[model samples]
Target: MATMITDECINCGACEPECPNTAIYQGGVEYDGLDGAKHAALSNDFFYIVPEKCTECVGFFDHEACAAVCPVDCCVPDPNIPESEEVLMTRARQLHPEQAFPEDYPSRFKAGAAAPAASAAPAAAAAPAAPVAAAPAGGATFVQSPLDALADTVPALESWDVPLTCFRCRGEFEVPFQFIKPGTVLHCPHCAGSFVPNTILYRDVAKRVTKFYDSFTAGLDAIRSRHQAEIERFEDQLRQSLQKLKDDVKEASADAALAGAPQKNRGFFG
Candidate 1:
């Protein structure tokens, strides 16, 4: 089933950026599919997801990103638009031609369960028994929130876990998204090393994200250039047509004036 936003949504819009298919839109706003098709807003009072564009994150992630990130738990499956895993995956392929999905691509359907959005890597799923209260030393740039004061009383790395690889150590770990952002360094649970930007993981992510942006801008520029050329061509055609009409009117007026004027008996035939 395609995911749907329930009316319980608070419109915090936390789920918008998390959607891989760009299916979610703000209340009363129109949405453009990845294929450039426009879809009307499903709801004017609450954020909505376009069912046609939603693949339930079948080929992109193990779980639905939008549902996982929704603060109000409003993102839920829509029984009205039920779809099989194969069908969802086919739509995913159509939406993202640049991404490759192997036969063994991750899918919540394959797992038979929708896992947490930011869970640990499959191999380290059970390694978070030791609770950490503060952000680790080294590459970590965890922004302190008001909640930090309660870290000592609360569990560590226990919420909003985001799976990330440590670039320097090549180690994998789960960190909370609340603490990290671009340039915020994170430590690998295995190596305890700080992250650097020169690793293969970083390069791969950078290349994919860069390609997405580059392709988007290039497409827009091509459309803009084509529209500009077409507009100019039509303007030139209309200008020629207007000039011809003006010239015709002027010639007609001159002929009418000559015919209406009395002619002198200079010619014997007149």
Candidate 2:
């Protein structure tokens, strides 16, 4: 059976990107399938899942990714959409042909049991166990080696104190560099404006600085794309307002020109 989002969803939007099939959609958003088919919003107030596209991650993972990451645990199996493992696997194959699934891939109907290890050879079994380097028979205390002690002295990553400025209220704050990560959203305490901190790298620890920056920028881009429709609407409204202002100005200028024109001599005198 395909997974469904329940009414208890808080619309946190954490499950949308985790789906391998892109079956999840935000509230009131139209969904477009890979086959160029469009579907209307299932829910106008809560996040909804497209049952047709949901395969419950049968061929991809042992468990459904949406349910795994949902903070509210609202992504549950749909009782109305009762589909067998075979049907789900077939759909998964159809959706992602490039990824191949084994015949016994873990599914609702299949038990995900590990295959038994092969038996050891008789000759190998007959071989004696290797001798062990034993500690002194006495209750000897173990002492740390020089290299082991040196390993403990390795320096930790130094954290940089970065200053955060609120975009709305212009309030200043300080946060540890480690607190600034990819996709981390912050809110201003004063203005309550949402802000996503930039990825800061004081030192190249684990060579992940560049990767973190790229991921952070990508998340910001995704956020921008998600609200692009709303942005375009605002832009359209601005354009209309500008046009109306221009029209009003033109009418006022025409009225002034007429009012300022000298009237001809009275017709009665002529």
Candidate 3:
């Protein structure tokens, strides 16, 4: 079954670029499919996944990339759009023909089962027996939030925070959201360095900026084309008017000359 975005979505836009089939779209944006069919926005207030294009990461990844990266875990299986593994795999193949899936590629039921549990057995045995170190004297004890504690226990939860390196000081920091605007500059608390957010720099924000520029240039080109056509039409009309005025002047001059010649003949006869 395809994945869906819940209303709890922060509209951070992290899910859009992670989609292999380009199924995710920002609020109010229209999208077109490879088959030349256009789709309207599903939600005007949050990012939404296109049900037709979403394959739940089948033939691509072991798990859904959007779900893996969402800070609030808003991406979930769509209960309304129930689909079988075969249907999802067919859609994946249709969306990406050049890409090939291995026989063991993940499905909704068998996803992540390919990985052996033998390695985790040793870690699980050592986890409970491991002793927690006591805080040093006069040192304050730090408390962790539920999310942070969960991330510590499960390594997979670490995907929620994306690491970003400061361009000025090279200090590394983690941001909760992956999708940030390119124009948004962030100041590093450690080094006081101001730089653009790197999470969406090459992916979402750059693509959005490029699309806006392309659209703006297209609009300008259309206006210029229309103005040029209008100018050419006006020039043609002015040339026709000048020609007509010249012809009228010539006709009047001819009539005046003919009338004077007859008077001259009369004067000569008298």
Candidate 4:
């Protein structure tokens, strides 16, 4: 099993140098593979592990060096990504081809502790990703990781701001996705006039937002069956990314807050 770091990490940098494979990295920092290729940081806030380079200390130590050194015990086996001793040893051999590993190399697996069905991650889970938010350990709340990619998938998901134009003053402004709803009112900053954003453009934007939310939810589901640990971390990022889209629909739909539509401007209001 590949070890992963959870959000419980204190950024103490305890696990960075412990890996024999040199797979550990600081949050927000990019990782440089031996092949001279540069990938974006897997995490921007806490320390992270590169599953590609993680052999669970096979052929090197009887236990995971990172887990041994972590102060907070954030390092743990990734159940979502199960790996057998053979696969781990093979990875160790490939990573350090100079050294020869005996068939009975030191490993965390007692025997065939895990099954290797896919290469680290499945094709859907292995698509090239951009830097995205990395979730901490556990299914707990999400913290920010700058452009960090985790959970073996898409880099951090991006955020979108809704644009609006005041009907009365014709002044343009933007609304957050969370605040956009059927009955939400767009108040003109320039003239203090207000109107309901139920126009054709508003409907179009709402549709796109719905589509985005739908696809994103689907992507999150795709992140499953990869690695249990990675799934948690991936969920961290997914929740953190959607934090802004918090269902403020109830608040936004309370059109009574505006009392009634514009009495004069009549902009986009019914």
Task: Give lDDT tens digits, candidate 3, residues 86-134.
Answer: 8989999998888778888775457343321111111111112111233
TM-score of 1: 0.42
lDDT of 1 by residue, 200-251 (tens): 5555654444433333333333344555778899999999999999999999
Question: Per-residue alpha-carbon lDDT of model 2 for 64-170, expressed as tens digits?
Answer: 88776554456777778888878988898988889877877765455663321111211111222112223545778867544334333422222434567887899
Model 4: per-residue Cα lDDT over 1-270, one tens digit each: 788777655665656766899999988989987678989998899888889899988888877877765544567777787788788888999999999877677776656533221222212313323234445788887754322233334322233467777777788887665565568776777788976766576668756665444444334433332235576899999998687556566557654547566555656865
TM-score of each: 0.42, 0.41, 0.41, 0.41
Ranking by lDDT: 1, 4, 2, 3
Cα RMSD of predicted structure 3? 23.7
**Preferred candidate (TM-score higher): 2 or 3:** 3
Clashes of each: 2, 0, 0, 13
Better of 1 and 2 by lDDT: 1
CA lDDT, candidate 2, residue 174: 60
Off by over 4 Å in 1: 33-37, 112-270
Model 4 CA lDDT for position 224: 33
Question: What are the lDDT figures for the candidates, one per model?
Answer: 0.67, 0.65, 0.64, 0.66
In model 1, state the lDDT of residue 107: 85
- Using TM-score as the yardstick, the better of models 1 and 2 is 1
In model 2, which residue pairs have backbone atoms overlapping below 3 Å? none
Off by over 4 Å in 3: 114-270
